[model samples]
Target: MNTFQLSCFLAVAEYLNFAQAAKQLHVTHPAVSQQIQSLEKELNVKLFQRTTRSVKLTDEGKVFLWDAKQIVAISDRAKKRFGGVAGGNIETLSIGCYNFPCMFLLADTLETLRTIRPELHPRLQEIPFQHIYRMLEEGDLDAVVGFKESANVKINALYKEVAKVPMVCICSGSHSLAGQKELRLCDIKEERFVLFVPPKGMLSIAQTQGQLMGERPPSEFYFCESAEAITVLVKAGYGISVLPDFLVPDTPLISRIPLKDVDQVSFGIYYKSLQGNPALKAFIQCAKENLTALDI
Candidate 1:
């Protein structure tokens, strides 16, 4: 009936132990019991089955549990939206990012939200490129920065473009192959390779270069989900990899060499249609100013 009752109900239903739930909620055990009893009376249902030893939710309680959580979520979103109504505009922005590019902007972007966009808080999540599209469709994320061009992904092609940096073939600086003036696909056909698995098998700039020289995909691979993970393995002298120039950070063991024959992926912002929120115009303008996007 009220927020207090709903909060108490959730705590009790989740833990099924009045004492434990009370401790978690920082309320007295009797207060928890009374709240649940009051909620049961308000709803006109036996929400819980209680014994001296244990507690269990009734079927009705289980069904109502889901609705209770949504009620809280909607309440929170409403609070955020309501805050914007007071001053200028307050909206929550959730941005999904692929692992490779997130390292650069994640901290800085959030810091700006803390200072500049004091009203509109932004939440950042690391996600695979495929998950971004699905989340956008479900209205989970407000935007993403990814290389993929899919049907559902709407691109905001701002003035900045992701520069075409040659995909560099990375090897341990001490590895015998590292000394070569240039590398062709034939250089490492017999050697083990480390690769970051591409979403939808989108060939990276290096993979495209490998194809240009008629090289077969490596026989063995150490597949990595994150660029950071791939670089760690490469630093440990695992095997050669074709990685974006950005990922080759300041690591001592790894070295990058241009592949000479591949196109660079465009780096840009992707957001769902702004039909739901009319205030995206100002936010997009702020984004354009903040992002100093360039080739890696």
Candidate 2:
């Protein structure tokens, strides 16, 4: 009912752990619990099902989560609007990216946007991939910048592609496949696979790797939450992974081989609409003009 209660609810919903949510909100665990309890009492509905080991959202909580995000975003925007008016008219936009690498792709675009709209402040947040689009739809994020397949377009969302980067096979420098100039599916089918955790609402990179592997799948599979973890595993010769070239860091310890059959991923900005937002409109244009020029 109140912004405070909604904040507590959302933090709890995101983390699914009261202690972790309290840590994130910089509040004590009991305080968060009290807020959730009060909100549930006021609504006459249980928002969460809590036990000793885990906390899961109730049916009502799942339904309210989207609305809560929108409510908080509107509240934040209103505060920022008035606060900006009192402090020299500074506008802020929350931009979300999946990971650090995806965020790095915005460097040139953000710089270019600064020149055109100096008063527009872009707040870049590296959000989890699964939550990024959900946050965008709930208005917590004004826009998102990341890679998507060329064919992946949503009816309600708009994507402005800046550039296309090919997927590559990532392996340890000392691996047998490292000496290959280019790799095909069969070339590495027998090797162990390290893949990203399955994401929601977008194309699954792991699933794509599975399709590429076809009938002859790798004997072992390892899943990781981040590209960094995947890289670490590959460096230790645990397994190889397929990722966008930019996500692979430049290091002699790892080798990246161009994928012969995979389609290039389009790197771009995904926004709901540019009809009313001047900052987002300017950012999309800047990204289109500048991101294409990046060496990556």
Which candidate number has the best lDDT?
A: 2
Model 1 bad stretches (over 4 Å): 1-89, 109-116, 150-166, 177-191, 198-201, 205-218, 274-295
Clashes of each: 1, 0
Give the per-residue lDDT digits (tens) of candidate 1, residues 1-296: 87777888888887888888899989999998898889899899988899998889999999999988989878888888756755675568777776645446445445554565566666678786656667866778777755546334354432223234456778888888777766766566676777756443344543453453354554566777666777788778887777666656667677777665445555546666766753344445444545444335
Model 2 worst lDDT window (10 residues): 198-207
What C-alpha lDDT values do all the predictions have? 0.66, 0.83
How close is each model in CA RMSD to the real structure?
Answer: 10.7, 16.3
Which candidate number maximizes TM-score?
2
TM-score of each: 0.56, 0.65
Question: For residues 16-65, could you state the per-residue lDDT of candidate 2 as single tens digits?
Answer: 99999999999999999999999999999999999999999999999999
